[model samples]
Target: MAEVLRLHGVRKRYGGGASPVVEVLHGIDLTLAAGAFAALVGPSGSGKSTLLNLMGLLEAPSDGEIWLAGEPVHAAPDAARTALRNRYLGFVFQFHHLLPAFSAEENVLMPVLAGRGRLSADDRRRARALLERTGLAAHAHKRPVQLSGGQQQRVAIVRALMNRPRLVLADEPTGNLDTHTAQEVFALLRELNREEGTAFLIVTHDPGLAARCDGQIHLQDGRLIEPDGAGVVTAAATAPLTAQ
Candidate 1:
């Protein structure tokens, strides 16, 4: 697979001044190839969410370089970064974060709406296809409050994929679901990842769910660790694994 993302010497710190500082990410380096599905598993305060945010461009890194697609991202202008994120990245949070007033179909079309105004006929068709893929076609007219937890999250997944992003960042997407529902959601995500060749970087706490991903990454106090390959280990991972 082609390399889709690369992070080198990445670092992030909070606070400045004489107190100047505590660092979370410490000169971390990582990469993701096209069509890869990986999980970020760590205990609370391990910095998984922070790392995911940095990858998603939701927050800028304090230092280091982030390459997306083939372009270096760390120094890109805000508009450029936003455009790139719109075109190539998708995000699913623990909360669906759907608009309360929009129907499921409308919610699914939000990213397109934000970037391109009204949905084209093709866009609508794609939205429907995604809804169907997530088993939410029947709920397209339903609002978030009208659907069950699983169904709402399914909509969120469909929304994330509406733009056909090459990379997806998910933070605790299944945190709110029951075990059975969470498994179902994970299965759906895996199917979509295989079918669409979309790379996923999910931050999850469930070991069982993390074990199902193609690769697993673990963090401790914001530093990346590969102890026993316990983190970022992959059932299908064939590349020489290294930690930096």
Candidate 2:
């Protein structure tokens, strides 16, 4: 399978001038193949968020390379990085972050509208189709305030897919839902991954959720710890880092 995302020798650090530079991520190396579903699991302060930020193009790495869809984007200019992020990446966070005033369909259309400044008939059709796929067709006209938490999250997921991105980065996507609702949402994500062939890198704290993924990438104090023959490369061999 072609690689959807790759990171080599990636490192991140904070504090430069006055305070001591704190290296959060050490020479990390990882690769996610096309259509793969994986979990990024680690304890608090393990640099999971920092690494995800770099991969999502929200931040730059202090060292090394990030190749998304074969483009070396780590050193790209801000405009280029923004363009690449829109073209190749989608994001879902713990919160739905939907506009309270917009209807479900309109919320799903937000990505296209933001990118193009206007929506076409085709965009509208796609949004409706996604809503239908996720069983939200009836709620298309409902505002976020009118919908339940799970419904709002479903709308957010649909919005992420509006651009048909090659990869989706989900940080604690099901973190706020009840156990049953969380399972349903996760099943929806997995079904979409299989049907759409979009790769997923999900950051989750739920052990069961992580175990359900095709593979898991464990991080500790800012380093990757992988099992042998796990099919992922790391900077160095280390003791297994269990999910918290």
Per-model TM against the reference: 0.91, 0.94
Runs with alpha carbons beyond 4 Å of true place in candidate 1: 227-244
RMSD for each model, in Å, please?
4.6, 4.1
Instruction: State the lDDT of candidate 2 residue by residue for 167-242, as single tens digits.
Output: 9999999999999999999999999999888988889999999988888888899988882225422234223333
Please give, for residues 52-93, the per-residue lDDT of candidate 1 as tens digits: 888888788888888899888888888988999999999999
lDDT of 1: 0.83
Model 2 clash number:
0
Distance (Å) between predicted and true CA of 46, model 2?
Answer: 0.3
- In candidate 2, stretches whose alpha carbon ends up further than 4 angstroms from where it belongs are 227-244
